[model samples]
Target: MPKDVYVDQDECTSCGQCADNLPEVFAMDDDDLAYVVDGGNTAAGEDAIQEEIDQCPGECIHWKE
Candidate 1:
């Protein structure tokens, strides 16, 4: 599977839902924007990331290669 967590800064609300769901992947930056911390660096690619995506109120998460 490809990278499953993506945060569109323009659309992100910085609600912390993604980080709350999966801290191993999602992280909030100093600017309060969400980003994939482990993205392509970890084995956690799809399932957990999908859960975070589903829980994001802003629906800012996406999965793509």
Candidate 2:
């Protein structure tokens, strides 16, 4: 439903951009890495999540549709 959400840990700088943009979908862990919240809740905020992915400074976010 939401395609495939992917985060490239190698390029991620833990900037929190994704989480900031889409708190409903993304969150920062103790490691400061951004991750999508699970439990089959990913597709609910598709547009906002996609916007966050596009805004990621490190180019680490992707949606494979």
In model 1, where is the ten-residue run with the lowest total lDDT?
38-47
Candidate 1: pairs in clash: none
User: TM-score for all predictions?
Assistant: 0.78, 0.76
Per-residue lDDT of model 1, residues 1-65, tens digit only: 36444688778998988877677777899999988785432647577777777878888888755
For all candidates, what are the clash counts?
0, 0
Model 2 lDDT, residue 50, Cα: 70
Candidate whose lDDT is highest: 1
Those runs of model 1 whose alpha carbons end farther than 4 Å from true positions after fitting are: 1-4, 39-45
Cα displacement (angstroms), candidate 2, residue 38, comes to: 0.7
